[model samples]
Target: MLQKTIHKSVACSGIGLHSGKKVRLVLRPAGENTGILFALQNGSGRRFLTPRPESVIATGLATTLGQGGDSLATVEHLMAAVRGLGIDNILVDVEGGEIPIMDGSAASFVYLLRMAGERTLSARRKVYRVTKPVEFKREGKLIRAEPCDGFHVDYTIEFPHPLIGRQSLAMQVTPQSFTAMLAKARTFGFLREVEYLRKNGLALGGSLDNAVVLDDYGVVNTEGLRFSDEFVRHKILDFVGDMAVLDAPLWGSFTVFASGHALNNAFLRHLWVNADEYLEEVSLGLEPVAGLEAEPGMVTASAAVLA
Candidate 1:
């Protein structure tokens, strides 16, 4: 498949989740292989910040990617929107430390791209295809990627809160699936977290408007649930967003259980440095498949069985 980018530049303004200040952001088309880069408007004229798994510097209420003298916080939502729209090349210009928490979901980003329209380029998309298996673990929380027909995630999350016990979602990644199924799932946190953030001078932009906040017993939001599994759904959504840091689109089968930013970023780091383990440059005529029983028309498994 060919690389894609936004046809026209678009801009929006919103409040930073942590900074609690209004920030302006512009989305511009980038050349092939540019990946998704952030350009800081500190008067240096677009200092670029590329998302490598190792750039993940913090995982407090949100994920932050950083390098010396450069950092971008709360990037998962924006990244999810980019991945969801299938935009392979783009430049994100931001005025603050983090992207705005527009509605606490990726839906706004989706709307922005739709309004700007999309243009496919002549260059083929670079894909990080999983050619083998790789895994990461920490204290029983784990993330694993195995060879698959296409990009897919089988994720599960658990919480002590009665409202968010255990939730799981497994889906093949596609523009359609991402928009309709994953993009609207809102980010969620506990009631205590909000107070803690405010006390520490964090999440200044947080409100009932952007995130799903739960007290000891039930949701504090009047709107109630968007999906029955919105909690786990949001986790999977964040994974899709963070996976965008791979630079190239990815094709793999990942099964994660009780995973979070730390484990997810760790898993990505393992996949990245060990490129020899699970990286492949492949072409596609149709949407890539996430998992396949065996190579099409191949009898390798049957041969082994007979042997």
Candidate 2:
């Protein structure tokens, strides 16, 4: 497969999930091998940032990347959109300290990226293929990964709330699957938690419009859930975004159970420490798979097995 970038520039503005302030984001086409870059605009100039596991400064409420006094917050959704769409090179311009939280899901980003369209680059795509199995566990939560030729995930989430007990989703991630099945899943939070965060001056912009808020009995949002198992689908979306910090596309079969941002980053750190033993950098030769060229808009079965 060849590397890809946007064909044109696109921009949008929305409320920040944490800052509660209006923020603008612009997506621009980048040159070959540019990878994903973030240009944080301030009064004086722009400070560039590259996402990395070690650069993760905070993962409490969201994944945050920082260097020196500069930090970006709530970046996971946009990152997920970039990776999920199979884009390897793009420039993300931000006018604030964070990307705008659009409906608390990747659906809006997906729409924007499609509007910008895709352009194939000259360079072959770089992929980090798992060569061995690795498991990271904390308390009862765990993330297990094994060798695979493509990215796939089997995710399970459990909560004690009456509306959400246990939910699971398994699928091989592809552009079609991501757009059709995962992008619309919205982030969710408990009503009591939202109240506490608001009192503490956090998540000031969060409301029913962006997130699926739930009380003791059921979903407080009038629209209810986007998917029957939206919670697990969102977890899978988050996993895709967190994995993008590796700076190369990762091809693995991952089984995750009740893992959050902190644990996900920890697992990535551990994997990086033993990268040579567990991972290998491979290049796709850009050859089309046999007997699969004529079918447009069809994701290969190997790349989109859902359960």
Candidate 3:
């Protein structure tokens, strides 16, 4: 399958979650083989980092990319949007340390990408399809990727809070599935944990306007949830976003248990470290590089993960 990119450039502005600084994000089309690259568009000096699975550094509150002395925080939502739309090449220009937290969901990003429209490129698409099972285990949380007929996931999350005790969701990751089922889920935080999160230099810019805040037993947001199981759906959104680090589409059935940003990154790292486990399918699971939806063609991969 061929690659895809935005036909035009689009921009959005918001505040950083930890830095509390206003930031602007511009998305522009990129050439084939250029992959997904992020440029820091500020006086901090322009440094670019490809959002690779191995490049993920911190996973505390969000998926953060750190290289040398620079970093990008809270990138999962933006990435999930990019990945779900099946776009392989795009340039993200962020003026601050973090991507804008627009509506705490990937829907806004989808709207922006749609506004720019999408065009097929000249390069064949690539996909990382699991051929063997490779697993990563941490504390009791474990994530495993196994060979499957197609890309799918079975994720289960458990929290001490009564509202979100245990939630599980399993689905095949598809463009239609993502937009109809996963796009509207909003990121949620606990109201009681807000102070501690703030104390730790996290969620400083979080507000009712951007995220869903849950109190002791119920939601505090004036607007209720966009989905009945918005929490689990949000987790799925995050998984899709984090998988974008591969800089391509992924195909496999993964079983995730109590995994968050850190574990998600680790899981991708495991697959990246074992090159033989995945094969690139440009035709079956990817869009053709020539603006055609073609069957995924399989190719063996090597050691690298992302930019």
Candidate 1 ranges with C-alpha deviation above 4 Å: 43-45, 285-307
* Top lDDT model: 2
Model 2 lDDT tens row, 88-187: 9999999989989999999999999999999988877777878899999999999999987778899999999887899989998878788998999888
lDDT on C-alpha atoms for all candidate structures = 0.82, 0.87, 0.79
Candidate number achieving the greatest TM-score relative to the actual structure: 2
lDDT of 3: 0.79
Q: What is the total number of backbone clashes in candidate 3?
A: 14
**Per-residue lDDT value at 286 in model 2:** 42
Looking at candidate 1, what is the lDDT of residue 18?
Answer: 87
The candidate 3 region of ten consecutive residues with least summed lDDT is 285-294
Model 3 CA deviation exceeding 4 Å by range:
277-307
Give candidate 2's error at residue 38 in angstroms.
0.1
- Arranged by TM-score, best first: 2, 1, 3
Model 2's alpha-carbon lDDT is 0.87
Candidate 2 Cα outliers beyond 4 Å, as residue runs: 288-307
Candidate 1 on 1-307: residue-level lDDT in tens?
5778899999999989988889889999888888898988776566788888888999887899887788888999889889876788999999987899988989889989888888878876667778877778899898888876556899989899888888888987767777888889999988898899899898889999999999999999999989989998899889888787868777788999988777778778888887775776665544433343323322111001011
